[model samples]
Target: MRMDWTALPEAVTKEVANRIDGSRVLPATAGDHAEIAATVAGARGKVFVKAARTELGVRSLRYELRVSEAVSGSHSPAVEWHFEAAGWLVVAFEHCEGPHADLSPGSTDLGLLAATLQDLGGTPAPDARLFVPSERFGFAHPAMDGDRLVHTDLTAANLIVTTQGLRIVDWAMATEAAPWVELAALVAWLIGAGHTPEQAEQWLAQHSAWHEVDPAVLTFFALRNAEKWALKSRQGSAGWMHDLADWTGQWAAYRRRPAN
Candidate 1:
């Protein structure tokens, strides 16, 4: 996924410049995603450009663009435009400068994450209903859905710690789901980020959305996510993926069999 700005086709570079009205482009190799990524600078403006030329890359770009278009919030970076240029799928986002969020236990950013999620949970889901988590993952306990949009991929890499506050980036996994559902879904990532099952629960308890969730609903999501992670672990992933699957299972186990 790492690629230099100069590596892009000249046609793409030209279109990118046209999009931002920029003449100078500097490569920004910060993210794990984006094939032709850089900071386009010139008289018109400075913006972050992300693009990909592969079929899957184009498809993924469209998904993210649509999802990004669905929400407008302080938690999200403002996107300038999304379009195809010289056979490359591309999008330009307002250039935001900050380090990725630190979600490790006890970090101040964790509170900021809570605030951001709270704000995001309040936003209604996009009207098009492009995807439905209920239909996707049929929890044995039945679906608990509402109009709220959910960002399923809330990894540290996707979060930015800005002077204003915590902002979430990357909406490729956005889907229609209950806000409380997202609260429940966040537990595994919390565990993966070094929160003990107990600590994660304590943190989740502070959120009003989690308070409204029925115990069975929480159990259903935990069990379902556990199963999903279990399968993902078997797919030959290493390191964090492997550890995530294990941590998620352990957290589910704790939830299933509470301490005496």
Candidate 2:
């Protein structure tokens, strides 16, 4: 079931109208269960609007607001400010300008993203109870150290290349977890995208300080993610399922090879 924005309570819409000075609104990008776009008032400048109604989503938005406030002075791009009113979480951010599709992985822009992640990891937010234990440890591993906050959903859609560099947009799934685990997940994503294990390892080693963790962990996470993608593909597109099957066969063959 999808959320219908028009069904939102009247009180929420009025609150949003009051926060931003203008009534003019434009349709923006839409995510799994939310719609995001830019808003403007009469000469007051622009702000971001994110509206959703799912219970989990509301929790995530509230947490993101806290994290954004906590890291405001740190200069990290992962953080953004959001407010809750009229049953919607309307967020105001610096109107950043950039075309979204052009920012791809492995491009020079990724360097800035890497730096942002590094800074976010380095900032210790021990008191932030934004992420529950189960949600934080559920994805990659069974046991998480719970040391740092991680932007768990780091997909291409969530990354925006702005004038300042790169900024991560979605914060609903961000949670506190072991830093290495999140890094491992990123490495896994790189490997699944066709990078050799060695190449992925080298890339992570150069990118983050917590690169000494077992490489086997990264491979495990990658395989897990691959299986999930394959299952989803089987449901959505036959061609994707076929490609995933072929990739799985190649992965098995590579796994059987002796270490050099």
lDDT of each: 0.76, 0.56
TM-score of each: 0.86, 0.71
Give stretches of model 2 more than 4 Å off.
1-10, 33-42, 73-94, 101-106, 132-146, 188-199, 208-210, 231-260
Question: Highest TM-score among the candidates is held by which one?
Answer: 1
Kindly report the root-mean-square deviation of model 2 from the true structure over all alpha carbons.
4.5
Candidate 2 lDDT (Cα, whole model)?
Answer: 0.56
lDDT of 2 by residue, 1-260 (tens): 33444665777666656666555655455455354444444345455665655677666556666666555423334333455665576665554456552323466755765777777676565465667435543444644456676776555556667776677665666677667655655553454466665565566676554564554555555466556656667677555355554554344334345551
Task: Please provide, for model 1 over 1-260, each residue's C-alpha lDDT reduced to its tens digit, 9 standing for 90 to 100.
Answer: 66777777788778877766776877875455567777788777888778888887777777777777767878877889877757888898877778878878889888888888888888898765446775545453445667788887787877888788887877766778778777776777788888888888888887788878787767767777788778878996656668768877977888797541
What are the C-alpha RMSDs, in order, of all predicted structures? 2.7, 4.5
